[model samples]
Each structure stands twice: as structure tokens, then as C-alpha cells.
Target: MRRRAVVFVALALALLTAAVGIWLAVAAAARDTDAAPPVSVSPSASAAPVTADDYCYVEAMIYYRVKEQELAETLLRKQGIEAGASGFATGIAARDEDELEDLRAWYLSWADARPAEPPTDGPCGGHGSDHAQMPGMPSWSALQGFAAAEHPDAEKRFAEILHAQNAGMIALVTLILEGDPHPAVAESAEAVLQQAEADQETLQGIIDAVP
Candidate 1:
């Protein structure tokens, strides 16, 4: 009888020990699971905020060229502009129209879609009035004044405005070149910068000759 009682107590202690071991293992696993870090998720490109870069240079250039082209065509339509000024306006109109078409195509290729015509009202808006804050962009009143001027005044006004706008575009193109622009955008910007520089030289001569 004594031997049997000792055997039974030993069996109970072994079972208790086994249960404790299993409980400890389960508790440790739970702690490890609780301590693990959360899985991270990346933000989507489409979720990019409006304040982000969004290739402002490309769109801004398009806007600038559109306005420049319009002004050039306006000058061409006006009477009494000197032969030199008329020729300059004609070149500007033609060059900008071609560039505008190229830019539209480039934008479509880059974005996989076309940007809105006339753009929306912000930096991303290709032709937004907000971009008027850029240096050398003529104000509404200045555009009106240019439209109304005649003869020598018209020539002088066109030279002054176009010169300023050209300088602004050159600066913008230079900035894009300095930064990490897309290959297509960089190529277009380089062409624009070169043309704008040459145009500026011509415009300077025109301004100097203005009587």
C-alpha cells in the first residue's frame, strides 16, 4: 500500500509539471505576437497631394508658351508695327504654336493622359491665373495697354513685354535643367531655353532700335 501511494504522488507531480510547461510556452508565444511591429503600407502615386512637385516646370512652360503665342498673334494682327517687329511676332507665333502642340503630346505621353485645357486654378493648373505671379508675366492691364498701343509705341511695348516674358521662360527652363526633370521634359526644356536665349538677343536689338 505505501509503495502504491508514492507512485500515485509521483504521477500527479509529473502531470502538474507538464501542464506548467505547456502554459509557459503558450504565454511566451502570446507575448511575442503582441510585441511584433505593424505591417507598413506605401502611399499610392494617385494619392499625391496638390502641393507636391507634380512636374510644375513642364506644365508651367506650356502655360507660358500659350500666353506668349496669343500675344504674338495679337501683335501680328495689329497695324503700324515695324517690319522687324512684325517678323519677330510672326516667328514667335509660329514657334510657340508648334511647341504647344509638342508639349501637349509630351504631357500626354508622360502622364498617360492629356492635361485639362486652360488648366485648373493652382500651380498644377497649366494655365491658371495664379501662375501670373511668375516674374515678367504681363498683367491684364499691361496686355490691354499693349493691345491698344500703335506704331512706335506698339513696337516698343511688344519688345518690352516679349523680352520680359522670354527672360522669365529662360529662367524657368534653366531651373528645370538644373533639377531632375524627366528625360522628355528635359529635352523639351533644353530646346526652349536655347530658343528663348536667341530670341532674347533679337529682342534686345529690337528694343535698342525702337525710336
Candidate 2:
């Protein structure tokens, strides 16, 4: 009877040890899993890749047009602009409005919404800043200066700003054309480039005529 009791006690001890070892192993495994980093899986590409530069160009051009329209409208409001410059401002206002519509249409076709801010560095990721500064566009101070000036100064400033804006537009269009732009975008850019070139000549003439 004593031997049987000893044997039973030994069997119970062995079972308890086995259970504790298993529990410890399981706890260690759980800790390891908790410490492990999650594996990341990349999605397969299903469509043609679009570059940030291309996207920036489209949105930036739209911004350019809107600014141009504003400047033209301001020119019209001035009291002393020459007849020719005033006529040109009117044409610019009309043309930019039409182009704005076209760009908005193209933008809406793919983009869910327009960019809240204009890109300055030819990329889309740095849109966190609220200031819409871009090359070829007049600074706020310059615009203000133009507004305050009289006659020849205002006209000269207007001509210079517009010329710079046109140059910026042409550069962006040319950049887009050199890449794989959408057919509609390509067509519009070519038209814009031709128009900008013509406007450059006209602006140069205006600048020269300013006294």
C-alpha cells in the first residue's frame, strides 16, 4: 500500500511538471509574437503610373489661369490703362475663363477634387503650405504695387507680370508635353503654348510702347 501511494504521488508530480512546462512555452511564444513586426504587402500595379510632376503641372496650370484672370480683371478696373492694354486685358480675362473651364473639366475627369493649394516644386506631396507661391506669378507685394501705381507704372507692371506668367505657363506646358500626358491635356497644353508665345510678343510690344 505504501509503495502504491508513493507511485501515485510520483505520477501526479510528473503530470504537474508537464503542464507547467507547456504553459511556460505557450507564454514565451505569445511574447515573441507580440514583439514581432507586422509584415507589409504591396498592392499590385493595375494601371499606368502617373508622376507627381505631371499631376503638379495640371493643377498648377489651373491655378495659373485663375490668377491670370484675377490680374486681368484688376487691370480692367484701373482708370488709366491705355486702350490697347485694356483691350488685351479684356481678351485675357475671357480667354482664361474659357481655359479654366476646360482645365476644371479635365481635372474632374480623374481627380476627385481640386488641390487646395498650388504646388511650387513640381510635386504633389508638399501641399501642406497655404501660400500659393509659384514661379512666373507676381508676388502679392508686386500685385499691390501695381494696384497703387498710376498710369505708366501700373501698365508696365501689368505687362511685366503677365509676361512672366506666360513664360511660366509655357515652361510647364512644355514640360508636360515632353512626358506622357493625357490626350486632352496634351492638346490643351499645345494650344496654351502657341497662345502664350503669341502673347509674349504682344507683351514685349506693350512693354516697349510704355512711356
How well does each candidate superpose onto the true structure, as a TM-score?
0.64, 0.67
Per TM-score, the best of the predicted structures is 2
lDDT per residue as tens, model 1, 126-179:
444335556578765566566666778877877888899888788767766776
Q: In candidate 1, how many clashes are counted?
A: 0
Query: Which residue ranges in model 2 land beyond 4 Å of their true spot?
Result: 1-54, 112-131
Ten residues in sequence with the least summed lDDT for candidate 1 = 45-54
For model 1, the stretches where C-alpha displacement exceeds 4 angstroms are: 1-54, 112-130
Model 1 clashing residue pairs (backbone)? none
**What are the per-residue Cα lDDT tens digits for candidate 2 across 1-211?**
9965654564454335433533332243245544322222123221334445545655666667766766666677778789888889899877876565544443433453344455544433443342154558676567656656567776788889899988877877887788776555566778988999999998888889987
Candidate 2 at 176: error in angstroms? 0.9
Clashes found in each candidate (C-alpha, N, C closer than 3 A)? 0, 0
